[model samples]
Target chain A: MKNLHVNFCGVAFKNPLVLASGVLGVTAPSLSRVIELGAGGITTKSLWREPHPGHPNPTMFGTKEYFMNAVGLSDAGLVKGVQTMKELRERTKEPIIANIVAGNIQDFGAIAEAIAELSPDAIEVNISCPNVESEFGKPFACSRIDAAAVTKLVRANVGDIPIAIKLSPNVESIVDIAKAVVDAGADAITAINTVGPGMRWNIDLRTPILSNRVGGVSGPAIFPIAVKAVYDIHAALPNTPIIATGGVNSGRDALEIMMAGGTLVGVGTAIYYHGDATWKKFTDEMSQWLEKSEFETLSDIIGIFHKA
Target chain B: MGCCGGGCGKQNGEETLHHELNTEPRAFVIDRMWEEAENIRTFVFKGTLHAKPGQFCMLWIPECDEKPFSIARDYDGEIWLTICKVGPATTRLFEMKAGDYVGIRGAYGQGFSTALTPSPSPKGRGEHSKVVLIGGGYGTAPLHFTGKCHQDAGSDVTMIIGARHKNLLIWEKESKDSGFRTLVATNDGSAGIQGFTTHILEDLLKNEAIDLVQTCGPEKMMRAIVEMCIDQGVPCEVSVERYMKCGFGICGQCVVETGEKMCQTGPVVSAEKAMTFSDFGVFHRGAEGQRKNW
Candidate 1:
C-alpha cells in the first residue's frame, strides 16, 4: 500500500485519518482504543478548566445521513484532561492533539498553558462548539474578533506548541474566521465543528429528541459542507494547515477535503456506524484511490484541486 | 453507500449487513402499567424492538434525561421496561400512567448468550445448554428474559432472583410463569431462602451440571458469582452498569479497567473477560466520567 502518512502542523501523523474530538475521546483507554483500532492520531474531547455538566441524555443520536449531539461539551476538566493526555502519551506512539474549549479568552490561555506540560503533538482550540451556546453564549467562532482573541491568548501561552483553531460552520464567513485565527498566530486550523444546533423531535412525544433541544449536525450529511468550507479556506490561506472535520465517513470524503486543502481528516460520527473498523476502511480506500493516480502519498494530493 | 452503515458501504455491497447505530428515538405509548413493588413499576409499551434476551433500550422521558433500561419482556410486539423509582429519569417515568408516551430505541449491546459461546460445551451441544441465571433486585428483570429465552430454546434453565426482601424481588413470578425452575432468596428471609443470592450458589453448583451462568446485580455479587462459576469450570456472562453518555462506545464513561466500553464490548461479558476488568467491582465513573467507588 502507498504511504498514507502526512505531517499536520509540524506533527507526523501515520495517516491522514485522525479521530475527531467529542467521540470516544475522553480517557487514555478510549483514545488508545481508537488508535489501536486504526486512527492515525487522536484529538481528545474538549478539555475544560473545570468539570462541565453537559446537557443530559439523549445528548446524541445518529442516522445513516447524520449524527446529532448536544452533549453540551461535558468534560472532566483540565487536571484530569492533562492526566489523561499524559497517560495517552505513555500508552501509544500515535500523535495526540489536546482539544481545549473555554467560555472566555483568559480560560483559553490557562488550558493552553496546562496542556503545554504534556506537550501534545498539537493543541486544537475549540472555539466553534455549537451546543454550549447557553453556557458559553454564542461560540467565539461567530465573530472574527472573538475567534482571534481566543486564538491569540492560546498562542501566547503555549510556547512553541502548534495550535490549530477549530472553526465552526454556523458562521457568516468560515474563511474570514479561519484567516483571522491564522493571522492571530494559529499554526493550523480544524475546519468546521458540527453544522447546527438543529432540532429533530418526534411528533408522538411532543418533544425534541435531545435534552438540549438542538444539537450540532454531523455524520455523512455534512460531508459536502466540510469540503466546501475547507475548499474556501484553502483557496484564501493556501499556506495554513487545516484539520478538516464534519461528515467525513469514507475515503472519498477524506480525499475530497484533502484536495480542497485539509491537512488531516477528523472522523467521529462514523464510529457510531462502523465502530473501530472506520479508520482502517478510510485509509485502505484512500490508498486504493491514490494507487490509480500519480500521487505516491496522501500529502501529494493536498490542495491538489487548487493547483489545477 | 448502501444501507448507510456510515456508508461503511462495507465491501461496496448493498447486501452487506452491518450494524447501524440507532440514533433516532421514537415515541411509544405505554400499553399497560403494573406496579410490582412500592418502588418498582413495570411499564408495557407497543413496539417491535426485536431485542435479544440481555440487550436494553434507552428510555427517554421527553425533555428529561434518557437512560438505558433492560427490555424486561417483549411479548408479540409489546416491550416492557421494569424501572425502580430512583433518579430523575425514573422519577419522571413513574409519574406517567397508561397510554402515556415515552421515547424508546435500542436492543443495543451484547446480551447474555442463551445459545452459549464456544459451540461445543463439555456436553458438546451449545444448543439446549443447561443454564443458571442469578439476578439481584432490578437486575432480575433481564435475567428473567434470558431464562425465558433459554426455555424457548428447549434448554433446561433455572432462575434465582433475590433482593433485600420479597417485595423488592422483580421477576420471580414472571420467571416461574415462563416454566423455568425459579428460586427466590432474600436477606430479610421474607421470601424463599433466608440469605443472599450468593448464599444459594454453592449448593446449586453442587447439584446442577450447569453449562453457563449469567448474572446482573450488585457488582460485588456479580463478581462473587463469576468467581464461583470459574471455580466450577462453567462459562459465565455478567451484565455490568456504569454511568454513561452517548450510551455507546464513543464515550469512555462506562469503560471498565479492561478498556472495554460496557455500552459496546459489554454490558454483557464472559467470565474470563470480567475477571480481567480491574475496576469491575471496585468503581464506576460518575456522570463526569470521574471514578466513583461503588
Candidate 2:
C-alpha cells in the first residue's frame, strides 16, 4: 500500500523499477501492459535508422546463469516507434525513455532530432552494439572516443531531453567510457550491454545455437559483470546516476544493483524469462526487503557496498 | 457452464498477490486435482502467478533444473497444469503431495485470444456449431481448455486425442464425460480408433461441417492438421512450444519468428499466421540464427 518512489538522473520514479530496453518494450500495447502492471517506466526497444532485418534465425541462446543474443539491434526505426511512444504516453502515467542506436556519428544527431519530436521523458544512447563494426559501420560504446563522439553529436542537437549513455561490458576500461559520456553531457548512465560475441553449439546438430554465430550474452549469467560495472562506474564518478542492466531477475537483483551504485535496475532478460507480474513482484518484494533492512529510502542503499 | 469448471480453471492472482520480484523462489501448494487419465493428471495450483493459458510456468525443485509446462486452465486465484511424467520435472511433480510446497514463477509467453470483442465464432459453438479439437501428447491440455471454452459458450464439441498407445491417452474419460463427442487414437491400436489422431481429424473434417478446429502436440502433426484445416478452410489455432530459457522477450531464447517474438507476442498463433513462420512446425532458431533442427 506504501509508495516506493526514487529518483533516477533527476527524474523521479514511483519505484526503482524500469523495463530495460530490449526487455519487451516492443510495442505500445505491451509497454502499456507493463506500466499497468506497475513498472516505474518503460524504455522502448532500441531503435535505428532503418528497419534492421537482423539475423536470419536462431538469434538467441541461453545458459542457467544467462542467455546470449545477437539480434543486431533489430528494430522498426524511430518513425514507426513514435506511434508506440505516443500511445504509451497517452495511456500510462509512467515515464517513457526512447532508446536510440545509430551506425554513424551523424546518424546519432539525426535520430536525436527525430526523437525530440516524440517528446519522451528521456533518451538512452546505445553505443555498445557489435553491429557497429565497420569503419562505415556503427561503432560499439567500448571506446571513450567512439562513445563520446556519439554522445556529443546527440547532445549538440537534442536539447532538454535527458540522455542516458548505455555502456558496453566488453570494454577493458569501462571508467574511461563512462567519463567520456559524462563529459559529452549525458544526463545518466545505463551500465553494461550484453557481453561479448558469445557463442553456443548444439552437438546433435553440429551447428551453432544462433544464426548469427555470435550474440551478446545476458540473463542470470551476466549479473556479476553488470554489478561490477555499476560499482566501478559509481566509484569512479560518485554523482553519476546509473541504471544497472543485464541479468537482474528479482527484487534481490534490483537491490544488489542499487547497492552496487545503480539508482535503478533494468529488467531485460528477466521480463522474457518471467513476465510483467515479475516487475510488480520485484518492486513489492524489494521494497519490503529494503523497508525491513531499515533503509530509509532507495537512496540510502545506493552504493552501500563501497561504504562497507 | 461457467468459464472454468471442475475447479480446474481460473485466470491468475497477479493483480492480488503482492509478491515482490525477489530472487527467492515463491511457494505454491496444490489446491485441487483433476485426474485426466491413469497417469496424466491436471494439478490445480492456488499460488501467485500472472499466467496466460497457452504460456508456461517453470516448476523448480532444489538440485533440479526447472522445467517448463503450459497453463492448461486458468481463473482468478488458480491455474491448472495438465502434466505427464515425461521427464525430470514432471516426475518430481508427480511425487508432490497436496500440502507440499512448490516453487513457481512466470506465466510466460503470448497466449491465444478468441477475439474477445464478441465476434461470431467461426464454428458457432452455441450447442449447435460442430467443433473438432485435436491434440497429441501433452498438447491435449490447451485444446481441452479450448473445448471447455467452446462448450461454455454453447458450442457442440468433439475432441480427438492421440498417443503412442491406449495407456498413453491422458484425459480420455474426462473428454468423454464432459459432453464432448470424444474420439481416441493410438499408434499401437491399443484402444480407441487405430492410427494417428490426424487421420481421425482428417476423416471428421471430410465428413462433418465442423465450424472450428484447434490443435496442439508434436509440431509435425499439428502442422499436418493445420495444413488440412487450411485446405478445408476451417479456422484453427495452434499452441506452440519452444525450448525456452527465459519466457520473456529479452533473452530471445524462445523466439519463434512469426514476424514477432513468440514469448512476447504469442504461444497460440493462428493457422493463417503460423504458416508464414519460417520455422513453423519444422525448425527453431538458436542464438546465432542457426536452424535448431527439431
Candidate 3:
C-alpha cells in the first residue's frame, strides 16, 4: 500500500487530512473525537486572549451549495482555550495546530506567545478571517503590511514553533499577502480562509439570513476559488508549505487540492454535508486513487499541475 | 419508531448512512399560512425535505436570518412550521403570506426516541407503555408531530399543552382534530386546568400509567417535567432550543452542559441525560459562547 504519511513543516501526520479550524474544534472533547475519527491532526478553533461573544443568533446559514458563517471567533478566552489544548496534547500524540486571532497586532503576538507556551505542533495565525471584519475592521490578510506585521510579531513571540499565516481569499492579491508574510518569517501558510463576506437574503422576511448580516462563505461552491488561491500561492512560493482549506468535500477534491500545492488538505464544511466521518472518507478515497494510479505518496502529486 | 436504547445507529456505531449534503437553500413556496394561536402561526409549504418528528430545518428568509424550527407536520408532500413571533426572524416569517417564497435546508438533527413504540397491549400492560407528551408555550409545536408518530405506531398517545393563557395555548384543536386525547392548561385558568402544565402532568402521573414522557418548551418547564419523570421512573425525552448556527452541528453554539452538541447528539435528549446537564434549566450559551440565564 502507498504510504499516506506526510511531514508538514516539521510535524508528522499519518495522512494529509487535518480537521480545519472552526468546524467541530470548539472544545477539547470535540477535537479529540475528530482525531479518533481518523484525522491526521486537528486545529483548535481560533482562540483569543479574552472571550469574544460573537454575533447573536443566525450567526450561520447554509444551502445545498454552500455555507456562510460569522461566528466572530467566539472562544473560551486564552486561559481556558490554552488549557483545553494542553489537555488535548496530554491525551494524544497527534499534531495540534493551535489557531489564534487577535483584535490587533500586539494582541496577536501576546496570544501567540501564550499559546506557544503550551507547545503545539504549530501555531496558525488567523489574520484573514472574513467573518470578524465587522468587529475588527478589514482582516489583516487584506493588507500586506498588516498581515506581515502580525506574522512577524507572532513568529517572534512563538520562537521556534512553526507559524502558518492563514490568508483571506477576499483580498485583491493573495500572493502579495502570502509573500509578505513568508518574507516576514512565516514558516508555513494556510491559503484562503473562506471567500467573500457574502450575504444571503430571506425574500419573504425582507431581511438578511445571518444575524451578522454577512459572513465568510465556504463549502463545495468555493472549492474552485480555494484551488486557484493555493495554486497561485504555491507558484509564487514553491518551497513554502501550504494548508489548503475551503470547500473540500470528497477524496477527489482533496486530491485536487494536493495537486494544486496543498501539503495538507483542510476538511471543514464537508463534515457539515457528509457528516463527521468525512475525514475518513476523504483519506480513504485519496488512498484508493493513489494506489490505482501507482503513486506511493502525496508528494508525487503535490503541485503536479505546475509541471511542464 | 422505537428508541434505540441510547445506541442510536448513527451514534457510537459504524457510519452506515449517507445523507445528501445540500448547502444551497431550496426555494419552498408557502402553500398556506394561518394563525394557530394568539401569536402562533402555521406555515404549510410545498417542499420535499423529508424530516423526522423531532428533527428541525433551518428556514432561510431571503435577506433575513435563518432559524431552526421543528417539523410540526409533514403530511402529504407538505411540510409545516408552527412558529411563534418571538424574535426578529420569526416575526419576519410571521409576516409572510401564502404565496411567498422561503429558503429551506435540512430536516437535521436526531429526532425523538422511537423506543417506546409498537404499543404495549392494554391487556398485557395498559399503563406501562403509554406515551405522554407535555409541551409548554410554543414548545408544543414539535410534540404534535411526536404524538402523531406514536399514535400511528399503535401506541396510546396523550398531549398536554400549556400556555400563558387560553389564547396562547397551541395545537389543542389540531391535536383533537388528529384524533389525539389532548389535555390543556392555562396559567390564567382561562381553559381546562387553571394552572401550569406541570400541575396537570402531576395529576396525570397520579391517575394514569404513562410509560414515557417527552416535552419541549421553556427550559424551566422542561426541567420540571424531567424532574417529575425521574421521580416517577418514566423515561422522558426533551427537545431543546439553543442559539444554533449550523443545524447539522458545526457551530457548537447549541451545546448543553454535557458537552453534547444539541445540533448533533440531539435537539432531542432523554430525561436521564438531560438531568446530567448542569446548565439545563439555569442557563444556556449565547452566540458568544458565554453563559446566559435561560
**Clash totals in order:** 2, 47, 28
Q: What share of the true interface contacts does each candidate keep?
A: 0.64, 0.09, 0.36
Residue A301, candidate 2: alpha-carbon lDDT: 87
Q: TM-score winner among the candidates?
A: 1
| Sort by lDDT, top down from the best | 1, 3, 2
DockQ for the candidates, in order: 0.55, 0.07, 0.28
lDDT of 3 by residue, B1-294 (tens): 332221222322223232354544677888998888888899999855666678788888766667788888765667889988888888888888878888888767777865454455433675435788889998899888777767655678889999888888888987898777889988889998888889989998898777778898999999999999899877788887776677667766676655567877778888888878788889986564556798
The regions of model 1 sitting more than 4 angstroms off are B1-21, B116-128
The residue-by-residue lDDT of candidate 1 on A119-182, one tens digit each, is: 8889999998889888879899999999889989999999999999999999888998998998
TM-score of chain B of each: 0.89, 0.81, 0.89
By DockQ rank, best first, the candidates go 1, 3, 2
After TM-score superposition, the amount by which residue A59's alpha carbon in candidate 3 deviates from its true location, in angstroms, is 5.3
TM-score of chain A of each: 0.98, 0.95, 0.98
Q: Tens digit of lDDT per residue, candidate 2, span A1-308? A: 34578887667888878888875555565576677778889888787766665553345444456766766666666656666678678877788888998777888889888888888888999888664353235345867888888888898878888899998888889888899889989888998888876776644334555556667878887899999999999999989889898789889989888999988788877764565457877888887887677677777889999999
**Predicted complex 1: CAPRI docking category:** medium
lDDT of each: 0.82, 0.72, 0.81
**Candidate 1, residue A287: how far the Cα is off, in Å:** 1.9
